[model samples]
Target: MFQSIPWLESNSELWLQISIVGLGLGAIVLFAETLHRLTGNSSELARKVVHIGTGNVILVAWWLQIPAWVGISASIIASLIALLSYYIPILPGINSVGRKSLGTFFYAISIGVLVAWFWPLQQFHYAAVGILVMAWGDGLAGLIGQKFGQHPYEVWGMKKSWEGSLTMALVSYAVSCLILLSVQGNVWQTWLVPVAIAIVATALESVSKLGIDNLTVPLGSAALGYYLSQLLPLGS
Candidate 1:
C-alpha cells in the first residue's frame, strides 16, 4: 500500500536531509533536558527552550524541500511523543510546564496541518509565517513576561502582561512581514497582512487556555495571512 504513494520514494539526498533534521531536533531536546537537569532550570524555561527551538524545523523542511509526507509523518510522530510525555519521561523537560497542558501536542498538529494545507500549493511562506510567529512571537512573549512583566493583568482567568503581549504583536508582525515581503514584494497588502496577523495572533494567544493557542495561533495566522493576501491583492 505504501509503495503506491509516490512520495514514499526517496533519494540519498533526501535521507541525508532527513537525518540532519532529526539530529538537529534531537539536539534541541537533549539541550533542553540538560539545561533542566544539570542547571536546575525551571520546567517552563526548559520547555520554552524546546518550544522556540523546535518550531524552527519548519525552516529546515522548507529549505530542504522535504516531502509533505515526511513533514506530516514527523508531525504525527511528534504529536504522539508529546502525548506520551504526559505519562512517560520522553523529553520530560519540554513538557513539564508545571500545569496541565497539551500545548506540545497542539503545536505538533499545527505543523502537520500547515504542511498539508500549503505544501501542495507551493505557498510555504504562509506556513513559515505561522510557525515563526508561534516560535518567535509567542516564545519571546513568554520569556519576556517571565523576566520583566511588571504590569500584570488577567484575561479570562489567565494572567498576562502588556510587555509580553506587545512582544507577541511586534514579533508576529515582523515575522509575517519579513516572510510575506520577501515572497509578495513591497505591496500594501504585504504590510496589511502582517498587521492583521499580528493582532489576530496576539488576541488568540492572550486568551489561550491550557495551551489551546498552540493549535489556534499558527493555523489561524496562516489561514488569515493567506486569506487576506488573496483579498487585498498586491497594490499601492
Candidate 2:
C-alpha cells in the first residue's frame, strides 16, 4: 500500500499541514455551534468571524512560504467581499440569495484558490477537488434534506436522515473524483482515490457533532485523497 502511493512519499508535510488546518477549523466550528445553541442565535455571525480570521492566518502563512501575491490578495479580498456582501447587499433581489449562502460560497471559493496556489503543486489537484466537493456536496445535502427529508434518523439527538447523508456522500465523491482525475491526468484511477475520499468525507459529515463540516470535510477529503494517491498513481 505504501509503495503504490508516490504522492504521499513526496508530500507528507503538505498533508500534515492540511490536517492541522482541518482540526483547527473543526474546533472553531464546534465552539461556534455550542455558543449559538446556548444563545439561540444562528451562529452564522460567529462562523463568519472565524472564517475571516482563519483566512487571514492562511494568507500570512502562505505568503511567507510561497511569495504568491495573487493568491494572498485573492484570499483577503474574497473574504472581505463575502463579508461585505452580507451587509451591503450587492444586487437587486440580492437579498433572496441570503447572506449565509453568499458568504459560504465566497469563503469556499477563496479557500479553494488558496489551497491550489499555496499547497504543494503535486497535491494541488486533490485539494481543489476536495474543496469543490465540500462546497457543492454539503450545500446540496443541506438544501435537499431541509426541504425534502421526511424520514429522519436521530443522530446525537438531532433529527438527520440516511437519505441526506447518502446524497452528500455520493455527490461529494463524484465531484471530487471528476475534478481530481481531470487535473491529475489519470482518469482510470479515479475509482481508487475519490471513492475513499467520499467515504471518509461522508462519515465525517454524518457525525460532525461539532458543525464544522466546512473545516472538516475539505481537509478530511484532502487527506483521504492524499493517502489514496499514495496507493494509486494519482498526481504529478
Candidate 3:
C-alpha cells in the first residue's frame, strides 16, 4: 500500500528545500543545547529555545511553498527520532530538559497531524496560530512565571500562577490575531474568533499535566479556531 515519493526526483528543488529546512531546524535545536552545555548555562533556557525554534520552523514550510506531505513527513520522522532519543540520548536538546515527559514528541506529532489533515484544506492558518501560541505564548509564560511569579496557584495539581496563565492568554491572543489577520485580512470583525480561541487554548494549557499541554494547546486551538471560523465569518 505504498506509492512513489513525489518529492524525491522530479521535484529536486522541493527535496532540497525540505532538506535545508529540516537540517536547519535540527541544527538550531542541537546548537542551542550544545551552547548551553559548553557555557554551563541553565538547561531550562535551552529547552525553551528549542521549543520556540521548532514551532517557528513550521512556518518555513509555508514560506518555501513546500508540499504539505513533505512537511508532515518531516514532523513525524523528527518526532519519532525524538521519542527514541528519550532512551538513546542521541539529541541532547531533546532530552536535556529535566522534566520527565514525552511532551516533545507530542508536540511534534500534534503539528505533523495538523499539517497532514487540516492544512491542505485552507485552514493552515489555524494550525499556525495554535502552534505559535504554544511556542511563543506557552514558552514565554514559563519563562516569565519562573522569573517573577509572585501570585501562585495550582490547576489540577499543576503548579502555575496568575502571572503565567495571564501571559499565556494575552500572548496567545496577540499571536493568534496577528497570524490570522495576516492570512485572512485586517477585518475588525475577525477579532472575536481569535480571542475565543486564545482563551480556550490558554485554559487547556493551564490544566495539562505531564506535558499533555503539548498536544492539547495546539490541537485545541486549531479545533476551536476552525469551528468558530465557521460560525463567525472572518471576511470583510
Error of 3 at 220 (Å): 0.6
Give the TM-score (vs. native) of candidate 1.
Answer: 0.93
Model 2 lDDT tens row, 1-236: 33567877677665565566556555655665566557765544445435434443443344234334434455566556555656774421222134434545445554755465437564556556556666667666666676688777876655677777888888887887677656666566776677777788777666655345666777777777776667775443
* CA lDDT, every model vs. true structure: 0.90, 0.59, 0.81
Residue-wise C-alpha lDDT for candidate 1, range 1-236, written one tens digit per residue: 44464554537688888999999999998998999999887788888988899989898899998999999999999999888888876666677534488889999999999999999999998999999999889999999998999999899899999999999999999999998888988878878888889999999999888899999999999999998877877763
Model 2, C-alpha of 148: deviation from truth (Å):
2.0
| Tens digits of per-residue lDDT for model 3, 40-132 | 767677878888888887677767767888877888897887788777866564474345777788898888887876767866777788788
TM of each candidate vs. truth: 0.93, 0.55, 0.90
Clashing pairs in 1: none
> In candidate 1, which residue ranges exceed 4 Å CA deviation?
1-10
Task: Report the C-alpha displacement of residue 138, candidate 1, in angstroms.
Answer: 0.6
Ranking by TM-score: 1, 3, 2
**lDDT score, candidate 3, position 46:** 82
Best by TM-score: 1
Report clashes for each candidate as comma-separated counts.
0, 2, 0
